[model samples]
Target: MPRTLRASDTVISGNPSPACTEPVDGEQAEQPVLGGAPSSASLDTLIQHLVPTADYYPENAYIFTFLLSSRLFIEPRELLARVCQLCIEQQQLDEPGLDKVRVRKFGPKLLQLLAEWTETFPRDLQEESTIWLLKDVVGSLARCEEAYCLRLHQVLQALHQKLAALGPGPESLLGADRPISYRTQPQASIHRELLCICSDPYRLAQQLTHMELVWLRHIGPEEFVQAFVNKDPLASTKPCFDEKTKNLEAYMRWFNRLCFLVATEVCMLSKKKRRAQVIEFFIEVARECFNIGNFNSLMAIVSSMNMRPVSRLKKTWAKVKTAKLFILEHQMDPTGNFCNYRTALRGAAHRSLTAHSTEKIVIPFFSLLIKDIYFLHEGCANRLPNGHVNFEKFLELVKQVGEFITWKQVECPFEQDPSITHYLCTAPVFSEDGLYLASYESESPENHTEKQRWKSLRSSILGKT
Candidate 1:
């Protein structure tokens, strides 16, 4: 401790002063940034260490591995295989969270794998796994736009190839060996879910329209038309009617779903011009149904179709009802009243007279106002032959009966017309604070004086004196 030396000799001899012996700054040393490329040895070490752990890893860990592997571009295929396995497991477990995370992490890669598998595999394997995988990828992509478009394009391309191979037949694309788990209800559910997620009515409408086109082409026009017609001879039977009713009900239900998608979910994608086109198509279909006398079908079509300026619905309904009435009238007899004719005339007289003859004679004179001499027989008595019958009373009775029968015969057709109900049932009435009041313009002094005079006269007439 007491040793001392000269500075140059002490430095040379490795005996330095304490102040010069301070350590270099660690902060000044170079450091690698996070998320940057690691050295090859480090990556190798990571893969070796992760392999065993990844085997026992839970679903979230697998997803994390997949995402990390994608960005790192190391062992992507191995990670993707593990992810696919996890996805299959998640589906079996029915764990929505795990399934969603797997889909979100690896949907694009899975789609790529599915496309490659479909191309590489045999026809049978392609039909079994590839098609199903494609469908699942599409379903998953509903949550991610980029993925959805990529998968959708892939599916469309695959579908085109499948369609080509199968040719123009129902069994071609679907195939006999492959099981199609996609039923109407599930398809509808998927469509609804997609609509909810996208909330883009135009996109939904476009998707549905494309689906409709594809399905229609596959089914063909003849089969589609047959589906709409009343086919069952046993339709009167409860079971048959029930089945048909159920089919129509399903169509109606799905139609309502489409309506909501177009109206609410697709608001962002909608354009006035495009909406007008849709409306125009609906009107064209409605007109076609009307021309074909398919009123019930027309009503169903109209009910399920969407239009803007909702008031137009009232006008459309009015047209449909009017058309139905016209058709009904055409189908029935043209005489003034079918019921009255059937009730008043005997069988022989009914058979003897034509509808036109009945209209001219019996209907005009007995059911309508007799405005001309043509309504009466040229030489017949004006009064009944019996003396007990008073002529004036007979004419009055005939007039009253004629009016009643005519009113009963020709139904007003419209249910809520004021003139049809003599303005009674539909007229509006107003009351004020538990009292009745009459509506009037402001009264003049002379009118007020006249009202007072009438009140005085009424009081005098009822006086005790």
Candidate 2:
């Protein structure tokens, strides 16, 4: 009484063909297989039942069928396409529904199908679609176990080999100047997906390590380091550098990232000894730049380590000044001595000038030194056991020195000419009570010249005025 199915309707209508002319006995056709007895038309019934739902079934069913069926019996591409679609849809939804859906029921099946597809699929489409799907699946499966993470790593390694064979052309898997537009969509999506996964710290740590390795292999280590460092939101707050590619700013960024990885849960490398080893590794990488006289890079790394501020840093300026004096005393090349002195002076000037405006940079060394000097000379001397010296008493001794130095204004004889007279004439003198002595005068050129000669001779022979 039922309508007969036609060959033309089989694919679309999910029916068996009418070409089988053998008549089914009524009882055999009507009876259900029971007690482990084989059905008369098991294969035909399966094909008929499965065909209708194949296009509309959910991920769990597709994964199940792919694993249970022989490779020859299923279209792997279509199966993987369904898996990818399921992942895309799942990711897009606000509620992931992972708890309601059973990954345990489906995970092994999916992994098995993936392994088979990796061996059998067309190389190009396999590299493009299948590998990407596997990466997503691996990212999903990351919540499972160390074994699954290891399996995903193996898959990625195999995929990378295929990608590498494409050579240096556009087909190459990685290139620095590859258009940002190509990366923008996937990277944005992946970043969001990663953020979601990172809620599970264990999974995130594994995923981060996996991604780091991928980046390291695809790009060189320096570029990998830069990608993380440059992407850091805090980088702008720390320091800015010139546009030069090779500089302290670049190295500092790299150093900071390495430290961040070691110190945080992102790497999960939390032993004190291990951290020290990582720091040592970073220093070794940095030493190459340091050897080329990159003091700025060295300083940046040292600062990032957050080590105790070096006690000897205070004495650095004094040591530099002393070394310059030594060079000068030994009659070394005056130019080198002058250069060394100027370097130290400029460094000191920069510190002092910066401190005058921004007190934060003034370390305790200079502050304490200034405080002690002022206390010893100015503080101790003024508050003597007796009353303060009267202004008239201070002036009396000063007047005597003025008269002794020059009876009349004169050109300084300290040097051969009038040009040097100003310095000699303006020199300060002090009385026995530590009061300052000073004088001012105006005189004709002849008197100025003679007075300056006597004052100069007295100063030179008797020590400075």
Could you say which candidate leads in TM-score? 2
Scored by lDDT, the top model is 1
TM-score of 2: 0.20
Q: Which stretches of candidate 1 lie over 4 Å from their true place?
A: 1-85, 90-94, 98-103, 125-130, 144-146, 149-153, 162-465
What TM-score would every model get versus the actual structure?
A: 0.17, 0.20
* Every candidate's lDDT: 0.30, 0.30
Task: Give lDDT: candidate 2, residue 67.
Answer: 28
Residue pairs in steric clash, candidate 2? Answer: 409-448, 410-448, 411-448
Could you give me the TM-score of model 1 versus the true structure?
A: 0.17
In the range 189-214, model 2's lDDT, one tens digit per residue, is 12322122223332322222222222
lDDT of 1 by residue, 368-464 (tens): 1211111221122222232111122213223333332332232221223223122111112111100000101011113565456434433443331
